[model samples]
Target: MKIFKRTKIKKYSKDGRILFTKEMKKEYTILIPMMLPIHFKFMKNILVKHGYKAELLNTSHSRIIEEGLQNVHNDTCYPALLVIGQLLDAIKSRKYDEDKLALIITQTGGGCRASNYIYLLRKALKKNKLEHIPVISFNLNGMEKNPGFMIRPSLLVQFVYATLYGDILMLLSNQVRPYEINPGETDRIVDKWVIKLSNELNGKSFFSKRNIKRNMEQIAADFAHIPVKKVDKIQVGIVGEIYMKYSPLGKNSLEELLAQEDAEVHIPGLMDFIIYTCDNRITDTKLYGINIIASFLAALLKNYLIRMQNMLIDAVKTQYIFKAPSSFDHIKSLVKGYIGTGVKMGEGWLLTAEMLELINSGIENIICTQPFGCLPNHISGKGMIRKIKERHQNANIVAIDYDSGATKINQENRIKLMLSTARLNLLKAADDSEAFLDNAQTR
Candidate 1:
């Protein structure tokens, strides 16, 4: 028998994982930015099931912002710097294997720095001596390529289940906290439910649309079981660019902090965008009379989503855990009134509409998060707070700007102050209501 000589394999670094060069031998790893918590659970499970080592990086609220200032250009939007800075930190962390990891970022392909963020991240990686790292851009518009990161039908179903479940938990927790008898009870429930749902997401054949509805109902029922007193709770509305409104980093963990302060947060659902996109088609027809069939179909899709929203609202209210339907139109009106319809970034009207809906639904306190250098949000976000306040005097609206150089402590303190005012207002109202009731009963 002839002796075979073995050649040594060369090692390479990707996002932050070990990369093997030989076919069917190299282990692949991917990183998805933490925009939504549910994404982390769903993506990690799917990637692992497919024989890939995937992990999500915990987004840094304080350090990432500071690191962004140190590394990124000062002129870039705060979100851009924070997101890139997060990836940079990940590459340096011991938790991430530097040889075979791939960095992931989402691209909207809009007229904003968000679109250019992917490019900026690449340069930053190169500067940090991570030049060999691969950055994956996740987009519906096909922004980048990584054939290995395919979303199979089964995976997509699970992804949606994860998203909807997370949405429900977020919505329900916000609604329950203000009325809960014990402070932090709602948060406790949320933490518990997230774990439960994460496990449920791992199960096969439980991802049907009907199953999703049942899961939501179960969540509502569980929340209802919580021993909360029926005290009038202060309702706060959060509306801004999609990411800023939903992402912890963008808003500096605004929602969680609000909950801690015993305030109810009403965030407009993502379904609003589907409806708004459809409306654009109808508006186009009215303005130009061009019968674009595709536009009309898009509008139909939005209508379907609106119906879904209505159904969700009905289900929640029928269970009697929170107040009835609150229109998200206030966000739109605020946007239009402040910046006009001319501004459009990832569907400009959507942000505005969400704000308006929250306000109209009787949740007056609002926070609009703006990226420090984001032109559209500046025009549409900061510029409109004053007008929104003027129109609704009770509207306690604050515009917090996120940037690389901005201090997290300062940002949080400012929000803390706003929340303090809300609590005071709520107390004053409760005192007045009790006094009024006493007088009425005596009379």
Candidate 2:
């Protein structure tokens, strides 16, 4: 006779939030929500390199929203609803073993609803009887701790470099994609670099400054070499809540739609947002007399990130075909009169700064996307627009609110109207230039 012993299953906690134990790290697959596709792809690769089996959820289906609305309150921030829904949708699909899975969500540890999403997700999981699956909060601040996952110094460095690389690739690709003589050439280059960079990040030269510079230069050069048509196109800039600005799923593929409308899209890179967050830490100390030690460390991190950004800019400057993003200092300076640095809720003053930065850079047409009922974004993003237009008369800005109920057709119609106005401005400018030339010739 053989005796069999059954393994014990842990009971749920009162709050349904369970800690991911170290033993779970071996068998659990962590699922990450997709935001900035290229960036998340690199981030996922970094996690795999560090011995975590990770997957970036890129599923864009109606059910994701449905699940979110069902789980979360409809009046909550749209981003919270969508993110929760996406995670739940994946779990219900039963593709992975429910007991052997974990979900990771980033927390800014700010005053925004984003910080509360992890708790909301846990509640939703409990509602669906899936509370056994642990949720990991991936944040720089010590907001939450997990035994299974830890971001060591080496891993953090790789993630930072990954972001820098992703930003450069996204910037250059956006510049060339609309103008490429051969369709798909720009994307092919992007795909190639993503894989090469992922492999290099796992190798010995990952931390080598020389190798990093060489990679950036090569990426810029490759994009520059792509055959492009020299035709005028509407230059549109996107600025708003972090997720809505970058996530194709969040904004209904705003970038792709702009390309179809014969427009060049310029999005402020993720590095700027990261830098802004660090700057806020310093701002807190100055404005509210917070801990000076934390402020000092924040300054150090901010400067380091600025140096990395400068390296990217230098590489892009070497290629005359692409226009690199402005430095953080330049972007920060633009918000001088419009908003104060002390406004640190949600996107805060950074949203206003990005809008001003876009207008000053000849990208006068802008789309400020935000979740419906998100008060902070409204105050900083849409509220600052009129003031910006008052100063820069040429600035054309449209604020779009994205919620589950917001129809795609209505949104597209509004954008099409904005595009019409942009076209008129372009034509008027060209005519004015010709008249000036004629007058000079007559003189």
Best by TM-score: 2
Name the regions of candidate 1 deviating beyond 4 angstroms: 1-26, 46-52, 59-62, 152-154, 178-205, 229-233, 273-311, 324-342, 435-439
Candidate 2 lDDT by residue in tens digits, 287-344: 9899799899999999999999999999999998788889999999989988999998
Q: Against the unseen true structure, what C-alpha lDDT does each candidate score?
A: 0.66, 0.90
Q: Model 1: per-residue lDDT, tens digit, 119-231?
A: 88877877777756666666644555455555566775555455455666767776776777787787777777667666665565365556556666777888888887776
Q: Estimate each model's TM-score.
A: 0.81, 0.96
Clashing pairs in 2: none
